[model samples]
Target: MSARGSVTAGRARSSSRDSILDSAGRLFGERGYSSVTVRDIASAAGVSAALVMKLYGSKEKLFAVAKPTEALLTDLDVPVSELGAALVFCVLMRRERGLREPWAMMPCTIQDTPRPEATRAKTRERYLAGTAGLMKDTTPDLRYASTVVALMTGFGEAVRTLGLFDGWDFDELVAHYAAIVQAQIDACQLAGQD
Candidate 1:
């Protein structure tokens, strides 16, 4: 191929890859890993099954690429006193920007996937442990960290997945919920000092 043709082909390939990843993420999020087949993802992506295989090699590989790997509350640069607002704002803004909430999909994955145990383990490792690690400076108790994770997950589900407070003013909602999260952190810190 000529230089120009090669560049065009590369762009087309990149587009196709992105489409495949988007479709895979949506399908896996909706139907869980085992329920979604390579062909299902390919059809959703508007590409042939052969192309998906050629690109990702297998359904598992595709899912690994498509799945959300980052923890929801990874940014801890803010002062510990302001962490709750920072974390809540980060999650809310991400949802507003249409980013996937991995925790929102946890219940479905645990119930629907072929390997529920694996899903549970991954969830604990990715979310619970990761969030707990961030909370270590505030509290040594894993239980407190776990509760914070649960609260955040439930709050995210309510706001994003269920649309519980759709019409509420964004700033008011953030402040209100941030207080609840902040209270938990405060309690954890107090307990740690004792």
Candidate 2:
């Protein structure tokens, strides 16, 4: 193939791969891991099951590929004080984009799968690491860190479930929720210093 044709083929392949991932993500989000199948994903993406396997190897690997864990982790890199706001903003942005809450899938994967234990464990560890990173303090109390993590995840889940952002100002809600999250982090920081 000519170089120009090769470039066009590469773009087409990239587009197909992305569409597959997008279909898989939507399916997994709508129906938990246990409920979704490779065939279902292939049908949703308008690809053959064999083709899906060829591209992603297995259902588990496809899920790992579909996950936005890296993007989620990057949200945790903001200033510790803005961590809560930034985290919540990330969730809201996903919803605004009509995408599923990627973090929410971790619990489902853990509860719903017997295989892929290592993948699930890695995801859990990453989530914990993100939580710990938000503390930004040496010797952070484990209990306090857990609370902050729970609050962050719970707030996001609740907003998604309740449609709390419906007809509301996104920025205002983010600031308000961030204050609550910051308060918890502040307490943790103070506790460590005492």
Q: Which of the numbered candidates is closest to the native, going by highest lDDT?
A: 1
Please give the clash total of every predicted structure, in order. Answer: 0, 0
lDDT tens digits by residue: candidate 1, 1-194: 89999999999999999999988876654434666898998998899999999999998788778852233556354566876776676566556546776667677778798999988878776776666666553444477677777888788788778998789876788799889888877777787788
In model 1, state the lDDT of residue 171: 74
Shift in Å, residue 64, candidate 1: 27
TM-score of model number 2: 0.56
Q: Report lDDT (CA) for all predictions.
A: 0.74, 0.71
Over all chains combined, what TM-score does candidate 1 have?
A: 0.58
For candidate 2, write residues 1-194 as lDDT tens digits: 99999999899778778878988876664444566899999998888899899888999999877842224654345567776776677777677646677655556667677667877677656776667666754453466566766776677667777665677688898888888877878877787778
Q: Identify the leading candidate in terms of TM-score.
A: 1
